[model samples]
Target: MRKWREIFGASQTDVAKIMGISPSVVSDYEKGRRTPGVKFIKRFVEALIKVDNERGWVVCKELIKSLNLNPEVIIDIRELDKPMNLDTFVTLVKGCLLTSTHSQKIIYGYTVLDSIATIQSLSGNEFWQIMGLTTERALIFTKVTTGRSPMIAVRVAPVKPAAVVLHGPKKVDPLAIILAEKEKIPLILSLASDVNELVNSLRTYARVKIIV
Candidate 1:
């Protein structure tokens, strides 16, 4: 309900887009219009966990090897193992909250294995799936790591191709394009419609940031 939105800082529109349902559908769920199905429930929980790892929790510890800090943290990141002082110089995350008001997170359902899905779909992400992976990613998550926030928002509904080829998989990296526009996050694209392509795209774009 209200707690889910608060936990993820997700607006109704955002959640609806994620859920592949109308904003009205989301509203109904919020209002208890329909009982959430198992798939819906699972996605919700996953999203909640992901958001929590990004934004909440009890006081956690972080290590600063260098005096510098990156612009921000990402969901899947890599790390090196080393020894460090358990108690020493550390900075506190400002808005750290441990127990959320709710026990589950929500998922807006959408997936696509093909890049060309864009020409035929209203939401590309709805059909997109993890097309590929180069390496098992590290759990480089964020937890209330705030700072001068990135101020960028782009309304990406759908883009038209000059010509539609009904044969090949629609080659589109909707996620890459969206995240790139907003947060300068990296992305990996694929020529195929599969999870491997997605993974490869992620690996390919891991450090190549787009600055608008």
Candidate 2:
């Protein structure tokens, strides 16, 4: 309950107001001090969705879109409690920035993907699941060869990630760099040893709070 409220960028008061309850009641439910029945749970979820809808359905829409994605394509996905600078995320992943673009540097979340599985399994519309809860997140592609395919997919997608990281690729394709620059999306090459190492690094980073 707390997670959903936070993901929607809503306060306990906000959800309580929408659900016609007191803020303390909402807090109690989230803290497990008070058990909620099925009817309350339904109202609680509807309240969160209503709050999100009032705010343009940003998080709500993304979550719905993500349900259609294949589990094999997405190794991991998480939303940060606070936004982190793009540079900090790059450093944590031992990444090298290939593109000069810096227009969108703040990221709210990350999604780690199996490069081959994603490219082969997802269609055009389903590809947006890579953004997870928001487009302001890093899309890390693992098992990359030339890094061209992922970049190409991003180019055709309706939305773009704050940054793109290629893992397991010693050399990135020149065209991928060009596409990233054209889109103004920071292109990164990660030096993490493997997918497990990469995911662990990101998990550690997510636990740390960044003031910015």
Candidate 3:
């Protein structure tokens, strides 16, 4: 239960909302000071499933199997450029097959391309989920710089007041941008092209200037 709280980036208050209780009640439940009924336990698990479904969690399938849940009650966001992991991918597919809404698209406006790209995994450390994954889509605008570049700014799923940054020559892609926004992972797109041309690409995502 503690692990689910972190993974969903949920607050005690959010848990209370899901469980129809107060924040203090959630704290008590977490500390094992309170014994919950079967109904409360089911609601708690369902809340976790809802959170994971929006952020594209495939492990939610395992959660269902282990818990013997109906897929119709599950929230599934499968329209990503790529699934973050195969287990999650399988879960999404399996859930979709079992659902009436198999053709729903969760992510749009991102295109995939062939290029050398690097992905970094962040520590699921406590400080990592201050912003919480509240939205299904996060919009990222990237403009690469050639010689000397302007600083880059990023916002992702679990936002922190202090920015986490990456600087290198990995050209950004629409797909990566969308994924970063969806997953709330900070990303940088390095380029060797003219700065203005790179900045112009920002028009694709938003009018906001991301001077990178």
Candidate 4:
């Protein structure tokens, strides 16, 4: 609930008013002092959807897709200030390019996600939200093993991002390389071990303004 609220840029009071409950009650629910029953959960979800729709982000559908995602996992999504080129980003991360580069694509933002959660939770359209508001953004997957799952998710998504970055020392899977070539998406493998630090570096370089 807190994640959805933050993602929608809604305040506790806002949610309380929408749900017809006291702000303290909403605070308690968020703090785990009170557990909402099924009826309240439904209302809570509706309130978030309504708030997002009114905000014109149309994030209600995206939030619904996120319901199955683990509440504990953090997905770093940000909107950057200016467009960045794929080659420049790869150089920043000191990553190896595993696939052929197409155009000097200008990326608007980047998404740092867990490969496993991406496979289990995100659908095709949901990937678009994580990739920012444009198809020219980079979808970066951390805590990856073979780097195949995230690429496969990209291949299946309704839209393909300009590039994909995989963090960790694992060798890039052959099939993943093939898929990136086929889709014409640049595939990068970063040897950086600290996923948090890597994400922070990318955020700093991209001058990301919005974090969700």
Provide C-alpha RMSD values for all models, in order: 21.0, 9.8, 17.1, 11.7
| Tens digit per residue, CA lDDT, model 1, 43-143 | 55444434434544221112111212121211233111221111110000011111112112211111122222222332334311111111122111111
Q: How many residue pairs clash in each candidate?
A: 33, 0, 3, 0
Superposed Cα RMSD, model 3:
17.1
Q: How well does candidate 4 match the true structure in TM-score terms?
A: 0.62
Candidate 1 residue 72 Cα shift, in angstroms, is 17
Better candidate by lDDT, 1 or 4: 4
Best by lDDT: 2
Candidate 3: count the clashes: 3
Cα lDDT for residue 96, candidate 4:
81
* TM of each candidate vs. truth: 0.26, 0.68, 0.28, 0.62
User: Positional deviation of 166 in candidate 1, in angstroms?
Assistant: 46
lDDT of 3 by residue, 33-116 (tens): 998786677568666655555656555556545443334321221124332232232232221111112122232212111111
In model 4, which regions exceed 4 Å deviation? 1-74, 123-134, 209-211
- Compose the digit string of candidate 2's lDDT tens values, residues 36-122: 897798678667766776777687557655577676777777655467887777788899889894845998778888988877888
Residue 184 accuracy (lDDT) in model 2:
92
Q: lDDT by residue for model 4 over 59-149, one digit each (tens)? A: 6446534554342234665555566777777876668888876557777777677776766766665555554433667777887888777
Model 1 residue 14 distance off true place after TM-score fit, in angstroms: 0.6
